[model samples]
Target chain A: MARAIPTRRRWLLSLLAWAVGLIIFFPILWTVLTSFKTEGEAIAAPPHILFFHWTLENYAEVQQRSNYIEHVTNSVVIALGSTLLALLIGVPAAWAAAFAPTRRTKDLLMWMLSTKMMPPVGVLVPIYLLFRDWGLLDTLTGLTVLMMLVNLPIVVWMLYTYFREIPADILEAARMDGARLFNEIVHVLAPMAAPGIASTMLLNIILAWNEAFWTLNLTAAKAAPLSAFIASYSSPEGLFWAKLSAASTMAIAPILILGWFSQRQLVRGLTFGAVK
Target chain B: MATLHTRSLARLMMAPSVAMLFLWMAVPLGMTLYFSFIRYNLLIPGPRSFVGFSNYYYFVTDPAFVAALVNTLVIIGGTLLITVIGGILLALLLDQPIFGQGIVRLLVISPFFVLPTVAALVWKNMMMNPVYGVFAQIARSLGLAPLDWFASVPLLSITLIVAWQWLPFATLILLTALQSLSEEQREAAEMDGARRFSIFFYIILPHLARAITVVILIETIFLLTVFAEILVTTNGGPGVATTNIAFLVYAQALLQFDVAGASAGGIIAVILANIVAVFLMRMIGRNLEA
Candidate 1:
């Protein structure tokens, strides 16, 4: 433990931190606040810091004009679906790299990571053509597969880091107890690695939810996610501040709530492999 | 026999994922390379003849290509510069024993988790509007004219907004790194009559070198392809001033339907990305080795 700082200095530092943090967070807060205002109040001169009349008209319009429920359903299906799919494939790969090391494991991991480094646009033309030709355009299956591959490397990386932390002696004991390979993984590894896997799944869902590029380009109307729904609010005919805020709030509310609850897990998972 | 069987089974279990990802990465990239070598514009339909390096030659020679490359570097470099320096300051500030630290941390990190589209919309509409924007309000209060950020210094403003969203990411990572530093090391330096600045320079900074690298690496990976933020804010304009390579590629491919040109640009972008990736891989590789 370190020595305690003086009370005055501590108070000053804490206040400064809070101020900076809040300022950075102000835009999102403003968006949420603006969602409740009428369109006139939203763009009022001097920026209406809580003096305006509140209304749910924007939300009503958003729900009515845009099939909000369908988009929400699409977001849930795609985000969770892709995360589940990624984990299904990533777990075995991570398990092998963690417990059954080979000379090629490091190279394999690096190669997978390198694929992530490749700009998504570098292959956009080909992918667009492939999807178009395959008749997979504007389909959840198309976006689902894209998100899975994009998130696969990250899922595997996190799982590998977590799996490495498990003691080999424990697994060796399981084997010595005459547990079969399938049974050992199912009975031992899965339970032990549940927290890590859960965090991985959560992080993947967030990533897939926020992914805008492919969703915007690949799906127009049929399979567009909430990201696309928010983007639709953007128009050349002046800023629709209230309606756009409403749409944004609806789009991000679920994941933002999830993030708020799981902040610690997310922070832990993000920093897990970075330190050691 | 069981041990051998288990090892083989584990290897086989991993094969499907490895194989699929390989195909997923290679097929599109390989086709991009092929398209880059031929006259394959989407508009012109015919037996595409092999035009060795012609598309690449045209892409390089074009003024827009040069401008796009410069803009890409500007955006990435500018954002990195602000985020790295600002993030370190914020991280250090937040690392202090702060009251309401959890709430502060959440607030700082909230931007990173916001969907890019939403972030862009909020910044463009709420914060930067010359008429009703918060920035304009403050400017008017100071008796100054409202500056239309999108019209004047459009690229710079977009870069600032994007940097704001990403700064929290850098700050959080660095804060975690800072928190892990040994307090005894700082106390020992203070005991030796080292100034706060000197202690930070000598003891704290060295510990943060790896974190900074990670922040830079991850930030660069996304910054190179910053599409939605640019698209929503400026749409690469006041006359192609803010158009980055990614947006350029999108325009070429989808908007203009110049597949040959987009393919060439895509190849160029991939090469540029790989250069940064190599540096990041080496750093991560060293860390993994240690």
Candidate 2:
């Protein structure tokens, strides 16, 4: 049933596709380009499209003005820490639900997902007060725990979907071959599920890295991640467009690269496997 | 295939996630419910007295609440409309065999990964600045005055930023769905002399129904709480023009230090979100059964 497309039609379609793509990508492209320009050039009358004196001065200034390294460290720790915690809690839960089904399994999974639907604002007061009472505000540990809780359901859901894809017969065969429970898991199941686990980790890190609500609310100085750090630029400080763009670009670059690599898994994780 | 021994092991394995999720859901929700019924303000540390429904009453009666409610609806509706329609068109275009398709796809999907604060700031300063922004430059080149986006139309501006962030998500999911459409089905319809519009309406649209619903439902949940975008850009400014329920609650609780009033607003937001959550849960529940 497959047919080759005509050359002219394909070329026309390509032109249209590229045009739309460029327009959609223009904002980010503009930001990256502006990051290399001077403050004056960034806000020039006719915005410099391509021809501009590029310099690393903005990047240097952004770093000199703020503790960029501290924020990046916080972002890394929170994203990776929360992702690891979620995986630790999520893997076992997903393995159980995927490998051993009960009447309540479906209901339990749905309930977990419904928790995600509960808007964070609904619980903001209690959590904020609790954090205050316990002196947990502006601490990396507090944020890590919160992010883990926020992303736990998605982690479990994605892992469950991935684990279900692995045939039960293979596990049965391992069991029949006199493999012990730990050996079967460590030797067979882990290897089979490695790709799924990797993608889930990638997606969770990206999510936690970019999570704004809690990070913005709970963090002030000591534990602020890049999200909050970049938000501090909202109050303009004397023609700092280039510096802001530089900070913004640095904050988002790592996650953006990871996101591109895991585009397929993103649909699966966010949608709870509804689309895929 | 599940034996009793296996089921017991499974229960043991599922305990940690289940227990934590239960506590996470129940504890704060119960506290919010309790707080909504009392007179509690962080600023005044007097003995909190039980006030039945007064908190909710005052919160609902506030003029800002009405404005926030309307802004929330508008932002959600506007973002959903733009993302879904634009997603469909983009998906259709990308479905065509094109040159450098990989690079094009990468370009289109990049915005979804941009952090909200970064996206909002980039839009506010670099693109929407009334004086020297690209939009201003374009308008002036054509002999027109540039509009101050946040000052004039704050909610719509926030909606545009949120939509740009989400459009990539919708397009990617819908395109995945579109790619899964069977080639034989399309060829059969074509062999029957179906026009392009007819094929789209009769075949493609129905196939994309589930993906579209998923996009709408997920987007709605996120859009209802459009916080950081407004926070970084407008801070719900220009006379509360862009304050959604989430931002209003935040202002009440954090900025104004009125805990009880904010808790009441929080409860209202929960109920509104649950209305949408019910339908989405049903759809996903049905999918699970299938």
lDDT: which candidate is best? 2
Looking at candidate 2, what TM-score does chain B attain? 0.98
| Native contacts conserved, per model | 0.70, 0.86
> How much is the TM-score of the A chain of model 1?
0.94
Error of 1 at B34 (Å): 0.3
Candidate with the greatest DockQ versus the true structure: 2
Candidate 2 TM-score over all chains jointly: 0.98
Candidate 1, after superposition: displacement of residue A137 in Å? 1.1
Span of 10 residues, lowest total lDDT, candidate 1 chain A: A267-276
Instruction: Report how far off residue B105 is in candidate 2 (Å).
Output: 0.8
Off by over 4 Å in 2: none
Local accuracy of candidate 1 as per-residue lDDT tens digits, A27-51: 9999999999988888787777887
Please give each candidate's TM-score. 0.97, 0.98
Error of 1 at A175 (Å): 2.1
For all candidates, state DockQ relative to the true structure: 0.69, 0.86
